[model samples]
Target: FRQIVVEFLRPPTHSDEQIRSMKAKANFPTDIGRRLRFENAFCRAWDLNLPPQQQHDVRQHILSYMLVFTTASRMRGIHPDGAPGLFDHTYEDNQVVWKPAPEDAAGMPAQAYGMQNGSADRAMGCLLV
Candidate 1:
């Protein structure tokens, strides 16, 4: 499980040859969106197949670091004036313009954007345990 998390957090390489040389098959997908969807499905399946106690433990671990994940997700882009880095952006009238999220209004789902109120309250309950 630690290795799974580590691999997920690792930065992607630019060279296709480098990605192909990696032992983990999960890194083979070049498309970021497709790779994310695949990894999400993989994690969901793994969690579902685990025993009840193990599943609970996994959820606890995730909840424990919810704040870190939330902060990282919310701050995942480069400054418009700074180098674009990994994120794709465009120039508008000689000014940098970061791409918008898929849903301009609500943005992504609560889980993707970090925990919602109900989930945060639930996490607090777990922490109190």
Candidate 2:
């Protein structure tokens, strides 16, 4: 995405009312109206708990995050555990046991979770998330 477009995708750090107004001004539906939000991407990036380099190939996290969230919001019924697989279906014993469950993804706000003080050697946060 262009830098301007990327910046536009950034969610406001204000109240929902403020966000709504901003969205309206920008012709968005307050809650993004299906556009990708930086925060939502950040959450999916957080989900893997993998190093930043690895996260790059994970569906270009930024684009897929909001797409996944939009899908989730519109979906009904039981969603699977794993959603964003590269393939359409997860085959097991010639049976489609699981498919992408991107719908169940959590669209987080654009907040980088900080650890006040912790050993880099220690695995934490999304490791347990």
Top model number, lDDT: 2
**lDDT per residue as tens, model 2, 20-100:** 444343321122122222344223222222222122121211122222111111111111222333222111221211122
- lDDT minimum window of 10 residues, candidate 1: 55-64
lDDT for position 20 in model 2:
40
Question: What TM-score do all the candidates reach, one by one?
Answer: 0.17, 0.17
Write down the TM-score for model 2.
0.17
Candidate 1 regions with alpha-carbon error over 4 angstroms: 1-12, 24-68, 71-129
User: What stretches of model 2 exceed 4 Å from their correct place?
Assistant: 1-12, 28-65, 69-129
Task: List pairs with backbone clashes in candidate 2.
Answer: 83-100, 83-101, 83-102
| lDDT against true structure, model 2 | 0.23
RMSD of each: 17.9, 15.5
